[model samples]
Target: MKVLLLGSGGREHALAWKLAQSPRLTTLFALPGNPGIARYARCLEGIPLTDHDAIVTVCGAEDIDLVVVGPEAPLVDGIADRLTAEGIPVFGPKQVAAQLEGSKLFTKELCKAHNIPTAAFGRFAEPAGARAFIEAQGAPIVLKADGLMAGKGVIVAMTLDEALAAVDEVFAMGVPGTEILIEEFLEGEEVSFFCLVDGETVLPFGSAQDHKRAFDGDQGPNTGGMGAYSPAPVFTPEIERRTLAEIVKPTARALADAEAEFRGVLFAGLMITSAGPKLIEYNVRFGDPECQVLLRRLDGDLLALLEATANGRLAGHDVTFRDDAALAIVMATRGYPGDYGKGSVIAGLDEADAVEGVTVFHAGTRLIGDRLTAHGGRVLNITALGTDVREARARAYEAVSLIDWPEGFCRTDIAWRALKL
Candidate 1:
């Protein structure tokens, strides 16, 4: 099958890598794909994802069988709806359904109305109301901007001053009619649960734990994700059962009832609390760094599964993952999740991938002549597979050591929760 994958991040590179391995895949193409993705698919550079008409033209020219969206922005922007209108099959939720990620208040309200377990939240259109709510909520509260901020919009304020300041900061961005969501911070271990929903059928698609903090020991500010490991040890069978029954299934049912039937992946950000698994938030597509590991352990035909989901033929289909564990360590420009310089020459990628069970997925990189240079934060994902999380972590770090980029840095402890190291 001919496929056109969207986005230009490590997640898209992983998807391209997996799709390229499928025997049924005839041609794989990527839009503004990274250097790592270019190895597996034809990279169509220059066309922005926002140009929906251009994407449709590419699909028609290539006779694309499926268009798999790797990022949430396009889906939230109604790219799937536009493609479907042109009779193109897309593996992503439409605009209405994508509100689950586009707006934090939307998910919170859905949880409240459906009785789905989640943190108590209050939405405010103005700053005074948000500040008043924050004062009432006290310290250790969570403040989230209504729209997307590339995963850095939410702030876990540990003090009253911080909480109030966060509100001001969000409003200072000056997005017209911007709303802030103040949520009661729930204490627990967080895990990402994924499922493929083709309007009605919900197929479990494995789980992973993401390191949102940029530094080791879970310190520093939140980022897109520094690193991740698949088959989260904390997400046990019992927890999985409760999550699906109480959260995932109910969410799908509620969306269906609301006439916003969803297709494609539902990435649930869950907090395993004393009561049970509670909804933290949701992403319409796959998670970066997390996807790098999950796809490394998948043991099925990715192209076929996605095509089936796009066509609404996922009723009886299920995916299988290798028993082996997969871990990914994100190597970023030294000042990542903040201001970082670009165009720093990087070397030794070939040697890093030569490490047994290791594959380095590029994120913010560009191949300049014969040199690979950093172009963005969270530049490379050194992913590896092993019998367990510990071995996977070792292999991933080993690959990290081989990379010759002085400007890059990665967290030394990726699966610390699982290994307790």
Candidate 2:
């Protein structure tokens, strides 16, 4: 099968790598892919991701058997709708369905209407209204920008002053125009639960614990993702079962009832509290570093699964993962989640990948002659597989240590929680 994968990030790189391993794959193309992805698939350059017309044209020209979207931004921008409208099958939800991630308020409303378990939230269109709600909710509340801010939208405030400050900051993004979401704080460990939905059938794809904070010990500002480990220990078999039955099932039913009928990966940001699992948020596509770890542990014909989902054949198939744990440590530009220099030459990738059970997935990297240069905040995802998370994490960091990029940084504790177990 000929495949066209979209996006230019570590997630796409991992997807491309896995898809390339399928014997059924005849040719693989990554649209404007990065350096690492280019090794596994032919990278289509110059065409912007938003150019649906160009993508559809290429799909026809390349006789692409399937189009898999790797990021939420394009999916939320209606790229899937456009591709499907052009008679090309796409593995992504439409714009309206993608509101699950595009607009925080939209998901909150969906949860309320469907009786889904989530934090009690209030939506506001003005700063003052948001401030009043923050005061009413008191300290240890949550503040979120109603619109997507690339995973930096939500803020967990531990005090009243911080809560008010978060509102002010979000509102300062714009007043009446700025949308705000203030919700009751649910204290607990967080895990990412992902499922693939082909309208009717919901298949549990994978699970991972993502470190969203920029630094170790969760002490820094939010980032796209600093690192991650797969098959989170906190999300045990029972939790997975309950998550599917209580959260994933109902959301799929609600989407079907609403005639949305999801067609791609649904990432649920979950808070596993004493009260069980509650929704923290949702992402219409796979998580970054989490995707790196999950894909490393995915042990089946990935192409077959993607094709099945895209063609609505999910009911006949079950998503599978290796029992072994996997971990991904993100190597970032020195000042990542903030300002950082770009185009610094990177080295030692070959040595890094030579480490047993390790693979380096590129993000924000470009091949400039014989050198790979950093081109974005999150630069590389060093993923490793092992019998347990501790071993996996050790292997991942070992590979990370091999990388020779002075201008890059990584969180040393990628799976500290699971490691503690």
Best by lDDT: 1
Give the Å shift of residue 332 in candidate 2.
Answer: 0.4
Q: lDDT (CA) for every model shown? A: 0.92, 0.89
Question: In candidate 2, which residue pairs get closer than 3 Å at backbone N, Cα or C atoms, i.e. clash?
Answer: none
Please provide, for model 1 over 372-409, each residue's C-alpha lDDT reduced to its tens digit, 9 standing for 90 to 100.
Answer: 99999999999999999989989989999989999999
lDDT of 2 by residue, 140-237 (tens): 98888766688877788999998887877877543357578888999899999999999899999889999999988888999999999989888888
- Give all TM-scores, in the order shown: 0.98, 0.98
What are the RMSD figures for all models against the true structure? 1.0, 1.3
Pairs that collide, model 1: none
Candidate 1 regions with alpha-carbon error over 4 angstroms: none
